[model samples]
Target: MREISLDRLRTLVAIADHGSFAEAARVLNLAPPTVSLHIADLEERVGGLLLSRTRGRVQPSAIGETLIERARRLLADAEQALEDVERQVQGLAGRVRLGASTGVIAQLIPQALETLSQEHAGIDVQVAVLTSQQTLQKLADGSLDIGVIALPQSPVKGLKIKPWRRDPVMAFLPARWACPDIISPAWLAAQPLILNDNSTRLSRQVGEWFATEGPQPTPRIQLNYNDAIKSLVAAGYGATVLPHEASTPAPESRIVMRPLQPSLWRELGIAHRAGEVERSTRHVLEVLWELEAL
Candidate 1:
C-alpha cells in the first residue's frame, strides 16, 4: 500500500471544519478541483466513500468522521515534531551530559544549573559525580560532553583542557585542637587525618605537600566525598584538607579552617572533546564558564 500523504489528511480536516470543499480549497489556497482530487485519492486508498451532500450542504459519512478525528491528532503531532526539531537547531533546547568531582558538583554545578535554567530553559545538563581520571576518560570516549577536573593533568589525546579556577586548599581542623596560625605538614601529620581516597588526585597532591617538609602522613580513613571528610573533622574525629571555594559554606562551629603554611591550592580545569561540539553542549559550556569566567 502507498504511504498516506499528510497533505491529504490536512485537506480532509479543513473540509470537515468548513463543511464545504470550496471553503477548504479557499483556506488551503488550492483550486477547488485539487481539493476534490485529494478526497477522491484518500477515499480510493481507504476503500470508502467519505462525504455526503444533503440540502446543498456537505457533511461527513461515518468513515469520514473517524478519519478526520485521527487526522487532526496526527497533524497536531507532526507540527509539534517539526517545532521541537527547530528549537534544537536554534540551540534553545537539548540535553548535555557533564561529569565532575563530588566537591565540584556541590560547589559549582548548582549555580551553573540555576543560571542555565534562567537563560536556556530548554537545555538540560545531566551531571555525574566522578573522579578526575574518570571524568577525563569519559570525555575522551564521548560518553560525556564536558568535565570539571583537577589540574596538572597529563595531556589526553582528543581532549581540550582550559583552566577554570584555582581555590585555596585549607585544613579543616577540629576547633578543640590547639592549632597554629598556619597549618604546616608536620603539624597536620601529627594529628589524626581524614583524607580523600587514594584513587583521587587530591590524595596525591596532599601527599606531595607533606613529603616536602615532613614525614608523609597516613590518613586514619580515606573517603571520596569532601562533605564526608568535613563531617569527620566536625565530629573532632580527625583533621582534613579540602579545597575551599568562596561559594562553599563556612566551616561549622566545631570545625576551624586554616590556610596551609606553604599556601597549597586546588586548580581545576574544564575539559571537552577537542573539536566540533554540538551547539547544545556548547550552550551548556557557556554557562559553566560563566561560573568563574576563568
Candidate 2:
C-alpha cells in the first residue's frame, strides 16, 4: 500500500475545486504538466481512477468522490497540525484574509477588528470589501479565508455558512425633512429619494418591500456606497434606506434614522468553504460567535 502524499492530495482538491488542470495549476502556482503528473501519480498509487476527464473539465468519479471526501479531511487535519505546531512556536501568529459585504464592513468591522486586535495582537487580519456575490466567488476561489454575507434560505454546496447576526433595514431621512418620526412606505415614497441600488440582498429586500406597497417612482439617485448614500440623505439630496447598522446615528447632527412603520431587516452570516476549519480562522470565528452572544 502506498502512503498518499499531502502534495498529491492538495493537487486533487485543487483540481476538483477548479474543474480543470489549467485552473488548478494556476491556483497551485505550478505548470499545468506538473499538476497533471501529480494527479497521475496519485491515481496510480490509489490503484483506482479518481477523476473523470471530459473535453477540458474534470470531475470526480465515484472512487474519485470518495477520495475527495477523504482528501478534504486529510488536508484539513494536515493544515491544522501545521497550525498547531506554529502556535506552539509562534503563539497564534498567522494571517487571515476575509471578504465582507459593504454593509458589515462599513458598519461593524472596525469595532470587531479593534476587539480582535486587542486579544490576538499576533494574528494579522486583512479585509476586502466586497458585495455578497463577490464574497462568495472569492471564497470559492480560495482567495478569501472567510466571507461575511447575507445568505438566502437555500445554501450553496461545498460551503459552510453560520448565522452571525441580524441587521434591520431602516429609513434614513434628511435631518430637516418634516416627516413623521417613523414613516410608512407610502409616506417615504412621497419624498424624493436616493436608494441603494438592487445589487445587494439588503437593497433587494427594500426594493421588494416597496414593490409590494404599490407602484412607486424610481429613486432619484441610484448609489452603491453606503456612506455616500447616508451623506446624500444628510445633505438633503434625498431620503435613503439603509440597514439598521447604517441607520445608527453618524454622531453628527445632520442625519436622522427612523425605523419604518413596518420594519424590515436582513440576516447576516459568516461563510467558509466546507471542510476542516483552520485553527486560526476557527479562533476568529469563535470571537464572532461570541459577538452574537453579546
Give the TM-score of each candidate: 0.86, 0.67
What is the lDDT for 225 in model 1? 85
In model 1, which regions exceed 4 Å deviation? 31-34, 154-158, 214-216, 274-280
Per-residue CA lDDT of candidate 2, range 1-294, in tens?
778888989999999999998999999999999998998998899888988888768989899999999999999999998986788355376777888866677777776777788887677778998988888888888898888888673586777888888766778887787868776788887789898777878777877777667675589988788788877887888988777654344524777878876778778888988998776777667667766633
Instruction: Output the TM-score of candidate 2.
Output: 0.67
In candidate 1 the C-alpha lDDT for residue 127 amounts to 96
Q: How well does candidate 2 score on lDDT at residue 77?
A: 96
Clashes of each: 0, 0
lDDT of 1: 0.90
lDDT digits (tens) for residues 80-126 of candidate 1: 99998888788899888999999998888998899889999999789
Pairs with steric clashes in candidate 2: none
